[model samples]
Target: KKRGVQTGLIRTLESALVWVFEQFPGTEAALNDLLTQESGPESLLIGKGSEAEMARALG
Candidate 1:
């Protein structure tokens, strides 16, 4: 049960990251820059849990 939930969460995160990369080709560099600037890779789903928020985090 717990393992299944964890697996699902991993899949969801992977999908979200992939979507981000696909939507913005330059997101990789921006994400790298964010990592250098920020403390850690906190959750990207920060605002309204929308795609816009995800894109904001990536780009």
Candidate 2:
């Protein structure tokens, strides 16, 4: 994939991660808000649980 597409996919997944986290219980909104604080090729660096959840969400 092109670097741009890779970056976009990463950002989308990361945004999804942040949204999922916010939908959960007891997370610092302020900190979770920081999830997408920057823009570019970055993901949440999430755990397996979140990764699975994200996969399901995407599917």
Candidate 3:
């Protein structure tokens, strides 16, 4: 169950990154490569609920 949650968070974050890259042209290659590299957010696994709460609060 924990693994599932982590995987879901990764997928969601990946989708968001793709959307961001799509919205801003010319950054696609850079973002795609960065997203897969060690320096990317995808390299980390954050708890889902906390991130959601943070997003809501920021909004």
Candidate 4:
């Protein structure tokens, strides 16, 4: 949603995440870590023209 790509189906996404966590148990922890590692909410002010923001967001 942040990058403005069109997407939907929340239940399917949730099921896919469950499948991923089941298939690779370690993946859930890494994803949890990413979710928890928050410095600030710079995403609210980001502009699409800058690739650096995208790179940082991905990292």
Candidate 5:
């Protein structure tokens, strides 16, 4: 069960990355900027609860 949860998390993260790349063109630079500014993985994970914040962050 733990392994399954880990696999699911990986898949979800992969999908989130794809979505970000597709939704926001030229995000590579923005991503670099965001990374240089923050220290946590929370900035990368786009959960349903954080949809609005994610949009704002990407913007």
Candidate 6:
């Protein structure tokens, strides 16, 4: 990063968004709104869906 800000990989979703809120307070509302507006049902489906073969195929 140009500013040397640390970056991380999002390997899993569990607690990841909560960690983001911890790192950047007061962003919860805006972030939630953005994700809601941007994500289609399929995207959210995959995110919350099982990782089994059938689930991935559905996504």
Best by TM-score: 4
What lDDT does each candidate get? 0.70, 0.54, 0.58, 0.60, 0.68, 0.54
Q: How well is each residue in 5-53 modelled by candidate 3, as lDDT tens digits?
A: 6647888988997786677665666545645777556433454346656
Candidate 4 versus the native: TM-score?
0.51
Instruction: Give the winner by lDDT: 4 or 6.
Output: 4
The window of 10 residues in a row where model 2 has the poorest summed lDDT is 39-48
Q: Model 4: which ten-residue window has the lowest total lDDT?
A: 39-48
Q: Residue-wise lDDT of candidate 2 within 9-53, one digit each (tens)? A: 888988987786668644545344545467311544535347656
Model 2 segments more than 4 A misplaced: 1-7, 26-59
Q: For candidate 3, what is the lDDT? A: 0.58
lDDT for each residue of candidate 5 in 1-59, tens digit (9 for 90 to 100): 24346547888998998887888797766666766765555646545346667556656
In model 5, where is the ten-residue run with the lowest total lDDT? 40-49
Candidate 3, residue 46: how far the Cα is off, in Å: 18
- RMSD to true structure for each model, in Å: 4.5, 9.0, 8.3, 7.6, 4.7, 13.8
For model 4, the local distance difference test gives: 0.60
**Would you estimate the TM-scores of all the predictions?**
0.49, 0.33, 0.38, 0.51, 0.45, 0.34
Worst lDDT 10-window in candidate 1: 40-49
Better of 1 and 4 by TM-score: 4
What is model 6's C-alpha RMSD?
13.8
How does model 6 fare in lDDT?
A: 0.54
lDDT of 2: 0.54
What is candidate 4's lDDT per residue for 1-59, written digit by digit as tens?
A: 26753477777889998997888757777655545657333433455337755444444
Error of 4 at 21 (Å): 0.3
C-alpha lDDT of residue 30 in model 3: 55
